[model samples]
Target: MKKRFVIWTAGIYILYVLVMGAYLFWWADFGVPEAYEGTGADPATFMTDRQLELSQDYSRYQSMLYFLGLPLEWIIYLGVLVFGVSRLFRDFGERVSRFTFINIPIYVLLLSTLTWVLTFPLDYARRTLSVNYGIGTQSFTGWMRDQLISFWIGTLIMAMLITVLYVLIRRFQKRWWLYAWMLMIPFMIFMMYIQPVVIDPLYNDFSRLSNPQLEEKILAMAEQADIPAERVYEVNMSEKTNAMNAYVNGIGSNLRIVLWDTTLNKLDESEVLFIMAHEIGHYVKNHLLWMLAGSIAVTFGGLYVGYRIFHVVINRWGNTWKVKGVTDVASLPALLLIFSLLSFIANPVELAVSRNAEKSADEYAIEMTQDREAAVGSFQQLTVTALSDVNPPALVKYLRYGHPTMMERITMLESYQQ
Candidate 1:
């Protein structure tokens, strides 16, 4: 059984390599259209020699850590099952409370804490690299505080999800996946509905956009776009990082436009308006609904596939792993491992869809604002401030980027003006 787990791990790596190679050597081979070729606003022109070098170095190092960390995480899940660590966790949880509901949270917290500890080195290394690059602003103590907050929040969510999942698994057996999927539809919507008002406030302070003039302009634009938003909100993010960002979040009444203070402070009025227009473009095009629909569809497929594979693996090795059945809290690692693999497989597809939606929004922003210069400047500023790779490797763009690359966006904007 342990040998089989090793083989499965090897197979996952092989799949990752094959997918990466295909993107690098084949799918990513296409060139920019000739119409966009003469854009004098090349990425090279946006940054000094030192800035360009720093950007490339940062990207390369970050990419390496990301790629390495993902597989290491999978292995941690595998290790728990193979080494009976998950069973020990389950036993400890049972000792803490006989009630399955109570025990589930205990087990989840234990697992979460273990993973958190094990993964801390990687997380800390990433943070250290960011700090060295002058991108991360949090103090070491503050960073750890955030990590603790994340752990508790994550544990609470995981516990609730696992408690419900096991209940459905026990009650519905083979059909548990369908029931879970059905329940998830509402839960996802509820999370989206509350995130802007509830979950987001935990991390940063949000208030109505301070610049009344800018807020009025944004609201007027939103009204023109038929957005329901009455006012724009700005979050205090400068204390956390220097990177600028803005987005539209939530659903229905909870739906609102949020700007990071970093964005408001760094960008000129025109660039900021263009950014807001791009966010408004998302609402105008109903991209959120579209994305939600896509997620529901992909999740349906993934959960169903994971359900099938979970049963097969459990049937073969349940006893060996000391996991009594799918209902066993000890079986959590198996479920997570299966889902993690599936999620990794689905990531590129998800990111590709997101890229297309973002491109559409970019076009809409340009159409709405009719200010190509502002759009171009915003993208350039974003790239510079974030130290983002303007033209990252094809594999990175395909697998990692959820939006069009900075270079791609600028080129399109420059071409649009022509």
Candidate 2:
């Protein structure tokens, strides 16, 4: 009986993947709407317009899937949960089925509501607490409005994606992960190229860098580093958030430097230069490509292990978080549970790699600029402006942080200076 049950489960899983893979491939190649091109405005204006278009497209696609997915998902989850439960407590099958079919929807709805409620306080803390600390500029009303907008927008989009994912998994079963990864590649590419162009501008206003001398200095630095200098662009970020930042993105003609207005306003020219130097270091080192390759490799490895363990657990106990195939609603909770646990275990390893990359960038900045004081000041200003915890616990740092803590960075800078 056990052997028969295992075979039945495996068969169902394989069929699920085959169906979902076909659907995902169709959707990836054809389902996406036309790309939006903004008017040839300044960099900031172009960015804002592009973001709005992407957000609208994303929202529309999401809404359609959200409403379509609910009932279908529930039915599959209930069917799988009942069948799996029956293997353990055969006599209690009827009772378990009755209880689960009724209780599962209620449980899920409550959980979703609770998550939204928890996010409210976290948002409040980010805004109100930052204001109290003199790091934020938005009024209470502005913050509240922003929070509400973000919440509703996030809820709608996530709800839709969850539905789509549930359906896909139900259709794909055990081999669903492979197809999902394949689908993710194009989605990730779209996000990388279009996201900064279309999505970011919705919340913030962008303007060109107004300082000629500073712009010239930045161009010089890029040229000195053997980075294409023409791609450098300044953005007015002060109209929305006060957080200071700089980043280097894209490659070849698409490559560009983005300096937020907050960084321009807060940091002196030298400090700004140092920050840009660090970002340029990332480009010079080809860190972005490395990160992407590393992430894909890790994900593939993790999924393989997870797939083996999932089948083993189900075989041993006849009760698994794994629901019917992939597209089923019940499968979502199981996948979420398993993925969350796996992600938690993998956090340290991921963070270690990220921290090393950051360290390398820091070293590169120092070497390129030969300006230790500028680096120290830039680090200090970043910590203060972002309101980052200066002394996070070691364990928390390992699990949660990508970059070394501010104190550690400053200490390193000091050591380099000596």
Candidate 3:
């Protein structure tokens, strides 16, 4: 029976991979637009001639393909969930109730696939669009090198973390979810600190902010906000891409504001100051801490609900999904399937919390800058540079987007200006 179950599971997994791989390739080729043509006059006026062209090209390309690519990706994810759960229950018997050696690769593959899919659009923007627009300095080879490095690094870290969690779950199978989450808090802190300081630097250069005047202005803003001023630093992001971004990252020793080199080059001194102030707002408000808390709360809640549902479903049709041990390799698909379903149900709660935080940040940015026009212009520039959808579908945005739409941001700024 075990051998037969293994054969069926292998077949299903192979089919799932083939179908999803084909969909990905198809979306990349046909779903996206090849170029962008918009009303912004004289690329030289707004950005470098090469940068302007590249921006337009990416915008066009993305707009063309987004709708098609997004839906297909979601469908593929659902398919994986369905087949994975089915196989898990069939292969592992009662021993699956314990966390075991079975299905480790399956979980890893599911995680890797999800990560790759979610980040692919961003990666493409950074590599292909940013380069074509003249904002990215990295070659295709360089981008590929970065991707490979990130993949290995991510795999190693996640493997260690998952292994530890799996072991803990085996020991405390009855209350594993709660204990795992307790472990996650420290893990998250470690990730935030090391991710930027160590992992990110592997892909891009990190250095002290070079411009003293600009640095002072940012420090002054941080002081005005009553936050630590010494944590601001610059990273050589322009070495890879022209997309401008700033964020506050880490806890304690890891805490700092990282500014992309491209952001400094593109925005004037005041614009840079305003952007830094906005990021400082996140720190002042303790947005990161609250966000982490919210995520943990939701994850634990979901796991609790999932644990009850899994037992109930198995009681009725335990033989159908083939779930044996909670720790078994076969059981992974069942766990993932349940988790995805729970996440889908909890989507609105997650979106509302994220949207609220983003809106708060936007308000903070405007208040700090007191220059509505600069804020508005910055919003527009960000939309254009990032090739972001100005007006995405409401349902799609609700399901996927963490930030408010471009138009929503502009509208908010316009009201503030009035």
Q: Compared with the true structure, what per-residue lDDT tens digits does model 1 show for residues 120-167?
A: 999999999888887888789878878888888889999999999999
Q: Give the residue spans of candidate 1 off by over 4 A.
A: 1-41
Per-prediction TM-score to the true structure, in the order listed:
0.92, 0.65, 0.72
Predicted model with the maximum TM-score? 1
Report the poorest 10 consecutive residues by lDDT, candidate 1.
29-38
A best-first ranking of the candidates according to their lDDT comes to 1, 3, 2
Q: What TM-score does structure 2 among the candidates reach? A: 0.65
In model 1, the Cα lDDT at residue 232 comes to 90
Collision count of model 1: 0
Candidate 2 Cα misplacement greater than 4 A, ranges: 1-114, 140-168, 226-231, 235-242, 251-254, 305-327, 386-389
lDDT of each: 0.86, 0.59, 0.64
For candidate 3, the 10 contiguous residues with the lowest summed lDDT are: 30-39
Model 2 Cα lDDT, one tens digit per residue, 2-110? 4665576568656664554444333433211122112111112223444434333332333223223322333333333545532222223324454434334333443
